[model samples]
Target: MNGQKLLIVEDDLGLQRQLRWAYDGYDVVGAHDRASAIDAVRAEEPAVVTLDLGLPPDPDGTSEGFATLAQILQLKPDTKVIVASGHGARESALNAIGAGAWDFYAKPIDIDALGLIVSRAFHVHALEAENRRLATPATTAFAGLITAAPEMLKVTRMIERVAAADVSVMLLGASGTGKEVLARGLHEASGRKGAFVAINCAAIPETLLESELFGHEKGAFTGAVKTIEGKIEQADGGTLFLDEIGDVPLSLQVKLLRFLQERVIERIGGRRAIAIDTRIVCATHRDIDAMVAAQSFREDLYYRLAEIVVRIPGLAERPGDAALLARHFLHRHAKAMGRPVTGLSADALAVIDGWGWAGNVRELENRMKRAVIMADGKLVTAADLDLESGGAPEPINLKAVREIADRKAIRHALARAEGNISNTAKLLGISRPTLYDLLKSYDLHA
Candidate 1:
């Protein structure tokens, strides 16, 4: 706390001195207006800021103060800004929070209560900063998988385990979920001598997909001028990644099954059978189970190909990952595009975390690339990303929304209470049992 800098954005000199001296442990800094506030933020990099929503040229209103708050947060997202409002404190507080202020206080400041809020804000800010720093774990060479989300971590562990075994593996997830990336990771991990071969069963028509997967001899067809080896034989002793395997034509499924079972392929119009020892890794966004039920896919082939199945959670399921991945993408693209942009604004990070990311990693990659190229400021804003800051509304399920709200409230109280359960319960105006139930329901550690 000694080194934790505090920025006071009060235009009034008496109040500024009073507030600065009141917080003895903090390294206090001052900014009298919107411009200075943003300057102090860039220069001092304060961890917390107490801002009065009344500053000149608009001291009679909060417009200037609101602008200052936005700019300060844009420079440093993790800096917790506590807003002070004399007029309509309650409504202003809510609006400030919506605008990304950490907390709000009323005028005629009770120094002690405001101090408590400041302390709580700093403590939570530290916790979150540490969480972000430690989120990424040391994993194997998965170059494309950029995540620290627990669900993705589990998938990574599964990939590592299955890749070591040299058996048929199936990956299931929504489109743009980085299936090909994981397939490449599997190939890198498999320690095979041959090349990593890939073929999208869905992209190619059924008439040509079979020949693509299983080779054809010379004069096998009108276009077959020379004896060509297919993806399977090309892989030889490496890995064969079959993307969108669910789209493999039923007529070709039998041949794939034979290759998996017999470890040999019969080239079209060829008498001799060639053997290969390629590890098969297949992925599909389609529900192969439903296809098997409809007889669109062969059940026997599905079983043969799916010696091990790994389900990759969609981007929505991997909470707390979007911002982390966004940071990575921003850094990578900024360097590649020769941009001076180094970070994202608070509003940009807020929108990224709250967005649904329907197209998953692919969409994120595109947005970040565009943002890096278009960004004019040192930090990327929501405008740069071409994204709406207003997030999608929550589902109309009262129970779900209530639980979400309760969990958030409980977590806030816990942060204020400094991890003391009894204090948290008291702060939340709830019994210990109720608090315990919430913690359990939300799978919170404490």
Candidate 2:
């Protein structure tokens, strides 16, 4: 046995025996009725269940089977329930999915096709379980940042080390690469009592950017009705996150450089210089070196902010994070929106893993939120994400589709098993020799 329990629920004794014979690697348990299925669940806590939606009492209908499905889910929401029904297959499939069943199969079951569904359910369940385990705070390298990729974790560690020095730190990364989040993490680790204030230089108009950074006195201008504290003053005794620092106009760069040099600011229309104790943490997607060489940004200011520069990796640069974050976002948005999305479909996960998320985590979050709201079934499919591949349309040949799926599954299994043939075969519900044969046929290496 592979140490994974599978509960087979069916009233037909012959079919029950057939199922047990089919799944030799699993610890198969039989349940002939709804009551017995519930009892079996309580006793075994199986990871996957193959349920027939035509149990006794309504063996000719789907009522009893649906009841069992409901009870099984209520008892163990995480259980992967693949429900089968011969009556009204389409309607039953839709109803079963709405009731939170992992998958549905029409009766006259093709054991081969059903086996594929069961194997995939197990794979998805395992992935979700691992994601939940890794999502905990204890497993993360930093608070509020969720990542399982080594490169991203390395960036977190670098931030943790740089937080204590209290020097100006500049973060360099592509847009939406979580520069502001890391800036806040640095502030939290610095143990600052004051508030962490953030200002996006690119979002603000140049005319008002100075007043926004360094406050103006009351009646400083025609529209200045009341005295206001600037972001720098608001972040006193804490960290000030300056996003898109490269967008600061050349005219204002002089004043910013002066403040960094003097550790004091002269608010607009006010001569009273204010000495503020603030740590500056700035970020920019632009190349500051290019800006300096182009004479667009002040060299002095660059040196001040770049005292402890850190480069953040893009989403594609961090392997496995796209799928991890996709799952995280799906659950978060589903709960917030009260959607019935239980998890990502195998197709959805594969698309996410293979996608090049140019918009980074922001793009992934937006996609998941949209997918959760738009998904009709219990599981979010790749179609819901609206991120279809930019390449050619899917091949029409059935052989081609099978080949593609097989290659992807093999690659994913190898990754999860860390290139161990034994574990890979177990994950794929096959023997080592079978895995070796497929790998050779597909030209895949473990």
Models 1 onward score TM values of 0.59, 0.60
Top candidate (lDDT)? 2
User: What lDDT tens digits, residue by residue, belong to model 2 across residues 1-446?
Assistant: 99789999989999999989998888999999999998888778799999988888988788998889888887678899998867567788778999999898877878889889989988998898776545432125466778755578778988999888879999999988899999999999988899999999999999999999999999999999999989999999999999999999999999999889888998889989999999999999998899999999988889998999899999877655676677788889899988889888777876787788888999999999999999999999999998875312344345546766777677566654546799779868999999989976655556
Which ranges in model 2 have alpha carbons more than 4 Å from their true place? 1-141, 390-446
Q: What do the candidate models score in CA lDDT, each in turn?
A: 0.82, 0.85
lDDT of 1 by residue, 1-446 (tens): 48999999999999999998899789899989988887777677788999998899998788998888888776677789999968566787689899999999888999999999999988998898767545535222364787645578878878878787867899999988899999888888878888999888889989888788888999998988999889999999899999999988777888888888889998988999898898999999998899999999999998888999999888877655676678788999999889999988867866786678889998998999999999998999988888885442432245556766675566445533435799879877989998888866555645
CA deviation > 4 Å runs, candidate 1: 1-141, 390-446
**lDDT value for candidate 1?**
0.82
Candidate 1 similarity to native, TM-score = 0.59
Clash count (model 2, backbone only) = 0
- Give, for candidate 2, the lowest lDDT window spanning 10 residues: 390-399
Q: List the residue pairs that clash in candidate 2.
A: none
Candidate 1 weakest lDDT stretch, 10 residues: 132-141
